[model samples]
Target: MTRKPPPDTTPDGHHVVIGGRRWRATDPAIPDDVGARLRVHLMAARRAVGVALRAHDPEAERAARDRVQSAKVALGERGTPWWEQSPEERRTRWQDGLAALDAQGAQGAQDA
Candidate 1:
């Protein structure tokens, strides 16, 4: 009897292919510390989206999506691949993103 081959996936966890179809995966270049912080931001943004929806607040919803986008860009999932960037470039990308998030939080606090 013939046996089926196992699915293929990249060692970096950035992609997997099964049945001749490709699928997306999270970027692997994110350091563990940065990854944990990004995860917290992502989850909070996602919850904000849900909360905003319940409250029928369009502005809050948009802000939450922007937060999610920023976090994704920081993780190199939305913009250029993190693996493709030099160490210095990667550092800049993440630092810029984090600064923006912090500014947003500060502005939000001032607004409230």
Candidate 2:
């Protein structure tokens, strides 16, 4: 399968335009390994949201959505715009997010 090209970002590199819609871009400062891990969490959370919806489980949906928000914030796609933060703050944001997501995963495994 052919892979799609990366989205086009604004001249300032703050947001990406996809299908004529603009969205905040992930922080460029994020290390590739860290970013990949965060994306994995984000996708998993998204899938969980879908699963919960299919099961008509409101509580599960809410929890899964919360995870989605956390992953987005950690990726610098939500909450305080990454551009507005200092380098140190940006680093802290992603690191803290990763830690929280990891903890959640651990908790989830125990629950299962």
Error of 2 at 92 (Å): 0.5
**lDDT per residue, candidate 2, 43-67, as tens digits?**
9999999999999999999999999
Output the worst ten-in-a-row residue range by lDDT, candidate 2: 19-28
> Candidate 1, residues 1-112: lDDT per residue as tens digits?
9997855887766666877776544456557887787777888889999999999999999989999999888877678876778988888887787778777778878988
**Which portions of model 2 show Cα errors greater than 4 Å?**
none
- Per-model C-alpha RMSD: 6.7, 0.7
Report, for every candidate in turn, its global Cα lDDT versus the true structure.
Answer: 0.79, 0.98
Give the distance in Å from residue 84's predicted Cα in candidate 1 to where it truly belongs.
2.3
